[model samples]
Target: MTDHALVLFSGGQDSATCLAWALDRFPHVETLGFDYGQRHRVELEVRAAFRERLARENPAWAARLGPDHLLTLDALREVSDTALTRETEITMQANGLPSTFVPGRNLLFVTFAAALAYRRGLRHLVAGMCETDYSGYPDCRDDTLKALQVAINLGMDRRFVLHTPLMWRDKKATWALAARLGGAALVEAIRVETHSCYLGDRTTLHAWGFGCGTCPACELRQRGWEAWAADPGKDETHD
Candidate 1:
């Protein structure tokens, strides 16, 4: 019964992978991005450049996915600073949470995404919210998502299926998923183009991807890439 899908894209490796997944499953796909004023605002630019690259190189896919939709919510400014929203040095929580864990981020994102999907007649909303590979964002948990989805659907009086392609994937597995979706070319794009750095530092490079490699996000990504490369099956998903 589902046809149209809206991807809550953030121009990161995970969201990019989700976008590819949505493209694979849906005949009609569109992207939704957020500009909620994170310090890594460069990701917005990265998303734009990615679309431009797609438009230039893969016009067919570009036409299929349509233009990237961005929502600029300044309410994050009202939210207190942690690290991602400020110029302060990034710190990690005792439970692996980093200052980058913008509270209610995924919750608000999915809720807004659901509302947008309802308005656009989209029955499926796809996002890359991985509890398997993350820095302790409580809202990324599957239970939270399920609850939020039901609440949003009830609030909107519409049935929207939220798809999380990377919920169980680690970084290495994530790379493998990307490779499967579009082969090495997609993997290469993620490595060279996507921005996942908390500090918004894309100048520095690493084996996994670009970022302040010392940050928690980078550390997890680096380890995941190593595990994936060392994987015997290589394409095997996490256990």
Candidate 2:
């Protein structure tokens, strides 16, 4: 039997790319999105629309990649102290965690994904968290994910794999990966359809993903895209 992989998708560039990657690798892939009261409800809406589009375009792909897929909106809404999920205005710091960082977010999200995977007899849980463009979020680091993996296993009395396909890769490499798996069309679709701006502004494009082009997330995304566009050869993965 082909092993099933559960993806923690956020309907953003990285997560959407990771979802595509999972689709290419695993015969059985399901996506789980969190609607954590994010300031950008647009992201959740896009996620639902993407899911629907997939179902309409390729029902088999949707069936294999959608049946266990879910959106946990209420769970995130209940915890609204973070700016990303609440009304608080985001504050960007030079070298510290941004106000956009949601406390215990990935922990809670992955825990839930793991629980769902365990119940379904799936051993793999995939997430798209990159340390390179993460902007000081402690939870986005490799160490945090490794530690969480161990904790999840101990807590659930079962072994589970948390796969971060984008952990070591930068945005340029990520864009290349998307192209490799599904060509430029997929990459373009991701940029156009996904939501990355913490503030929900979608008027312009930032290098890493689409956003306000001013927030730290937008800055990192913009820089990455500029870097890649300047030198496509920089990404060895590019064909």
Candidate 3:
């Protein structure tokens, strides 16, 4: 597409992958990150480092992706009760909303991103919210996304397309797609650089991108990695 794309980047695995995917698809890409006053402050640092590294490693990519592309909104820092933002203990619930589910998080993020897009004259916005691996978050559901898309357009008086590349894809499928779009090295870079840990622990290896591996996010990530490792042939290498 010739239009620019804005991504809701969390400096995490899925979002990182989504960022790369957006880069390949859109002529211009910008990222919007939230400093929602989560329990993990290290994630913000990690995100900053990621942007810097991406700029240094690939100058062309960096030039295409400007430093001004990174936008940090601090709306959630005030409300600190949810697991994703400020809870100390993480519960692994089989069903229902997890402690990490922040109320109106995606809504706020998407709203801000949409506003940014509208200002930049960009109609496309991409996010990495997957219902399959999500921790029972209502915002990650397909219906919510569709409704939000409509709401954003109606509210902003502009037509905007919300691109959920990993909406239906499971964790395994996510890994496969990452490999396909950005290759093994890029995927590996995402795994290491991206912060998926809710607790902000950077030590040890988990099934997920990087965390205790017991958390819902980590579990899904690990399972996806295992699936990819088991069947490397299924991994796509082309766009």
Candidate 4:
């Protein structure tokens, strides 16, 4: 197997940053995205453009960047009735998690990613799942992913390292990470090319990105952008 990595790029701010992180670390890195019939499927639209711009940001990254893959997991819609999969309102469940939590989304994502990695001879899997500043998706927890890594390795009988660079990072720190990876150019690319709205609204453009500015994703992004813009120096500890 090769020492290449496969990043679960969702065309969101965090995933874009993680992609850059992978390119910086790995000699060869590929990207994988899912089309699970999400309401914000618009995020998929910007993936190609973001990757193009990201490659141009650095010569080494362009050379290290490899093939891109997209998977159509329409089964998620059949199994998930969350706001992200349907037109329902975003709300907190009685269990205290957001309605946007797709039951096994991240689990399925990594599982499939592992399967793909097996065939592609890629040894590392990277994703942008975070619990620090997010809708309380249980699947995004560190414990969940750690356990999943063990399960995948056992079931597949292959050693694979799952990397979650943004696991402990908040949005402001995530923005800082983008700036660190590709400077103001990368930050602007994320601001303009990434999509994180749950409502799939792309008409209005905010300083952070394009979204309704009221959804949990937009609010979190906007808050982080404002915080970072006010004082990026406060992100020293983020590294």
Candidate 5:
């Protein structure tokens, strides 16, 4: 695989950390995001603002980071009935995986990203998918991602490395990683700028990010921060 990589940026804490990971490793890096009829579309706005900030404040890194590309999957609107896209009050848990779990969302995202990577001659596709301290989403598992990597490569007839920097790291470790990657400023920005709230509520800011503070994602992040603030000695194993 070549050195250039494309990151699946969602402007969330994990993806932002993974972007920094790509910046630290590969010489050439870019970002790709999707608009798949998600109610949390505000993250896209944050994504654009993040790229703009990187270009303005950190020009040296931003130059190699390249442009942030956004694509739309309008079909998702018709098929998905999840709270993330539907006009229903978001539900934390249900009979099975939470109502937020859009079926095959990650699968579709990575496949499309792989195609884009092949077309652009990029060899690596980085994403921020975590199993620990994450919502019960099967697609976020490592095995699922690994299988998809092989399938995508064979389907595209190209060798594309899929990098998931946040697969094992919990939310606390993710914050520490952000501190290591972009230092204090980036950490602070991630806390305030990124929106991980399932309800898309930024009115009540939490220690980690803006959220409704009651949703599963927000609860997980808050717990991680509690642990992080206790003994956050720059430890990668903050969890």
Candidate 6:
């Protein structure tokens, strides 16, 4: 594996923290984002500013940060009719999955990211897909990612390692990761800049971040914040 890496940054709390992790480990780190016509497309709008802030505030990360690539996969919306792509209410489906779960979203994301990384000569691909604190998307599971990694390497004939820093950690621990990565500055950036609302609601801002505060994403973030606030040291033992 080379020292270069590509992070599948979604301008969300998890992905931003993963970006920090990438920057800390990889001397050359780039970012890749997909625009699948999500309801919360505002998340895409915040990426540049957050990257700018990180580069401006942290010289070390700035030195390692590379170009960011945003690819529009509008076809994903044409195929996926989830709440994340439409104005439907966020609810649990009869299949035991959340309505916001976009089928094959992360799968496609990693595949595309792998393609880009192959062209860029990046040997490592980092993402924030987590089964621990997520919308119960099967594609986010560690097993799925591991299997996909093998397929990607076989199909592309290149060894690309997939790194999921938040796979085992819950949302509270994700917050702790940000704090540990870049201290209060990274945490504040994630709290203020990242967007994770399934409703696309950015009109209101909460301590955890901006969202409808009632959607599953917002609720999970809120709960994580509350838990982390109560005991910030709880994640100190996490690997």
Cα-based RMSD of the predictions, in order? 2.2, 3.1, 2.8, 1.3, 2.1, 1.1
Flag clash pairs in model 2. Answer: 207-221, 207-222, 208-221, 208-222
Residue 141 accuracy (lDDT) in model 1: 93
lDDT of each: 0.80, 0.76, 0.76, 0.91, 0.82, 0.91
Model 6: pairs clashing at backbone N, Cα or C within 3 Å: none
- lDDT tens per residue, model 6, 1-239: 39899999998888999999999899999999899999999999999999999998899999999999999999999999899999988889999998999998999999999999989999999999888878778999999999999999999999999999899999999988888889899889999999988787889989899999998989999999988988887356354
Ranking by TM-score: 6, 4, 5, 1, 3, 2
- lDDT (0-100) at residue 61 of candidate 2? 62
Write model 1 residue lDDT over 74-154, tens digit each, in one string.
897568577988889877777677778788888889988887787788899998998987877898998999998889888
Q: Cα RMSD for candidate 3?
A: 2.8
TM-score of each: 0.92, 0.86, 0.88, 0.97, 0.93, 0.97
The 10-residue segment of model 3 with minimum total lDDT is: 66-75
- Please say which candidate is ahead in TM-score: 2 or 6: 6
Number of the top TM-score candidate: 6
Which of the predicted structures, 3 or 5, would earn the higher lDDT when compared with the native? 5
Q: Candidate 5 lDDT, tens digit per residue, 1-239?
A: 39999999987777887887888888889899999878878888898777666556566677788767888998877788888888786665646788888888999999989888888889999999988778879999999999999998888888888888888888888887877877787777778877787777878776777898887778887887777778676845522
The digit string of per-residue lDDT tens for model 2 on 1-239 reads 23888888888878887887777777888888776667877776788666565555555566677564665557666765667867877786555767788778888899989988887888888899878767677888999999999999999998898889888888878777777766666666776778877788877764455678776666666776776677665345421
lDDT of 1 at 159: 84
Candidate 4's displacement at residue 163, Å, is: 0.6
Q: Is candidate 1 or candidate 4 better by TM-score?
A: 4
